[model samples]
Target: MQTEVIIVGGSFAGLSAALMLARARRDVLVIDAGKPRNRFASHSHGVLGMDGIAGSDLLKTARQQLLDYPSVRWLSGEAVEAAVGADGVQVSLADGTLATARKLLLATGISDQLPDIPGLAERWGSTVLHCPYCHGYEVGGGAIGVLGGVEGAAAKAALLADWGTITFFSQGLPITDDEAASLQQRGVQIETTPVVAVQGEQPQWLELVLADGRHSAQRALFAPALQAMATPLVEQLGCRLVDSPLGVLIDVDAQKQTSVPGVYAAGDASVIGNITLASAEGVRAGVGIHHALVAEDSRPRPTAG
Candidate 1:
């Protein structure tokens, strides 16, 4: 199919970007595989004007609202490869179909490489969660646990303490003298034992076993998921990625245009903010793509030799 812009990953970012392009009367196609990282969360918070809404429902509403612009088309499919062309780019789909556009936006998003702890996946969106601001308040005033992941993760324990009594599980993560003193000053429980597994299936609170093989209980648990960039399409297009707090992210200029001429990235694929942040980024990216395309449109034609 022919379009002015092709946006991959149709959740918050892709959809929001598409909204702007569509409003500007551009023929935009959104190709999504329907796998959103936030699919597990029942309600999203901290997003201005969208607090207390389910993640899936918010996406559904965005897609429905996009229908007002007939220029936008939604497709439920995965994008596999992208190739640059004189006009713009050609994106290949998993089903062997081809789509062409003058510019490309990759909202392809990322995946959390969760540790191989049993029952974590099932409780991921529920009682066991990430992002203290997003999920902490709901699970507040209860016994909370933070599993040590990489270095500097002890900070997460202190952050969650605002909502409840906090515990730092340094399983195999030896606490230094200073860290122990800090926990004592803050009334935080310091457990240095390895977490054998979690107990309960629904809420699935961690049944943290201590070094002495004793079980320390927590009503709600927090563990940082190991995150990796979801797509190389940006790298394939030569976008330079620089240091980002969450990890490395594609470097985009003021227009959300990557180092590559006609490529853009938004949402979790580009920013590590919450859903509200993702949507806002997506809208900005969409507007940026519009200006980029307009500039290319208005460029002068070369004189015949």
Candidate 2:
């Protein structure tokens, strides 16, 4: 089916952009696979007005609101592949359905690759967490642990000191002199023993099992996971990708337009941010797409010779 705009991944960014296009009375189609990066979290934080709301509930309400527009459509399927043609862009779904649109917005979020520690995966969004700003306050100023593996683990530990007593577990990973100095200045303790596993229950309580058979109990563990794109559609569409400290992300401009013309990206796929920033980027992409379409329609045509 043909549409003015096709938004793939109907999470925060996709849905936000679709709302704009729909408001403009553009025929917009949002294809979603029903998986959001924050789906694991029981409640969302740091988002204004909707603070403490469950991620699923917020998305449910947003989806309902977007669908109220007459010009908007939603598809409950994954976009397996995408290609840009002379006229526009085409997206192929997993079920082999084809969708064509003059412009495409990619809000396909990212996936987190957790550390290979046992029991950690099960308590991920509940006790083992990322982004102190998102879940720190709930720690209740208790003992907090930071697992080392990803870049800037020490810095994260130091920053999280304001939330609770921090212990930086190097896990045999080397820490720089500067990092050590900073940790000391921030009153963050350093534990070089490798973490063999995590034993705990939900709602912010954990025990880190050290390789030497020692266990350290803490209110919560902050471990940075390696992030990867949730879908291969970016590569399939030939959009430019850039490397960030966390992972590779799609390259976008001030207006959220991707390297490929008529293609735009937002949310976790294009930038490392939270729900608020993702929604903001979505709004920018939506306005950018709308203006581009208007310009294209208004361009003067050559008279017959």
Candidate 3:
């Protein structure tokens, strides 16, 4: 079947973009496999005007809002492959169906790679979190532990110091004497030994076990929690990637159009942006796609006999 645009991933980003296109009377189809990075997160914070809303509930509301427009179609499945073709772009779904559209927006989000620790996965969004702006307030004024997987964790620990008593466990980072002294001046305790595991009576209260067999009790834990975005669909269509501290990043202009023509990306697939920012990016992409389609239709064609 043919559509004006195909949006891959139906979370905050894809849905927001589709809403704009549908409102403009464009045929849009959104495909999602139901795997969102924030599914474990019960409530999402730090989203302007949307603080403390359940992540899944926000998705449902966005989907409902998008559905109010008849020009939009939501497909609850995966868009496995995407490629540019003579028909503009083609996407194949998991259910063995083919879809063609004049434009494509890739919004597949990323996955957080947690440390190799037992029980941490179960408590990821509950107690073990990455973003301070998102979950810091809940654990404020409590005993906190920051696990440094990537560099620059010390600075993050300092930013979080205002909210709690900060203890940074390097997991094994060799630091200069000056660095240790700086952390000391900043009132941040530094631990360089390896961490055996994190334990606690409940998911909210956690304790870190040292390799030397020592244990430290704590109420909250933070980690860099670096992620690898799922941007294969965009990469498949020849989108140029740029490097960032986050991970493999896509270089796009202000309008959310990728370096490649007729292709756009939003959400975590472009750069590591938050849910609200991703939604905004999607809206920009929708506008760009709409204008591109209008331009195509505006060009004068050969008159038929």
Residue range 1-305, candidate 3, lDDT tens digits: 78889998898888888988998999998988998878988899988888999999989988888888888888888887889877698999979989999998887877777888776776788778888887889886778888875667777777778778889888787766766777777788888877778777666578888889998887788876666766467657778888766567677898888887788888887767678788888888888888889999999999999
**2 versus 3: better TM-score goes to:** 2
Ranking the candidates on TM-score from highest down gives 2, 3, 1
Best by lDDT: 2
Output the better candidate (1/3) by TM-score: 3
What C-alpha lDDT do the candidate models reach, one value each? 0.82, 0.92, 0.82
Name model 3 segments beyond 4 Å from true: 176-182
lDDT of 3: 0.82
Error of 1 at 152 (Å): 2.4
Q: Model 1 over residues 226-245: C-alpha lDDT tens digits?
A: 66678767666777887664
Give the TM-scores of the predictions, in the order they appear.
0.92, 0.97, 0.93
Q: What's the C-alpha lDDT at position 98 in model 3?
A: 91
Q: Distance from true position, residue 296, model 3, in Å? A: 1.9
For 192-276, candidate 2 gives per-residue lDDT tens digits of 9899999977774689999999999999999988889899998888888899988888999988999999999999999899999
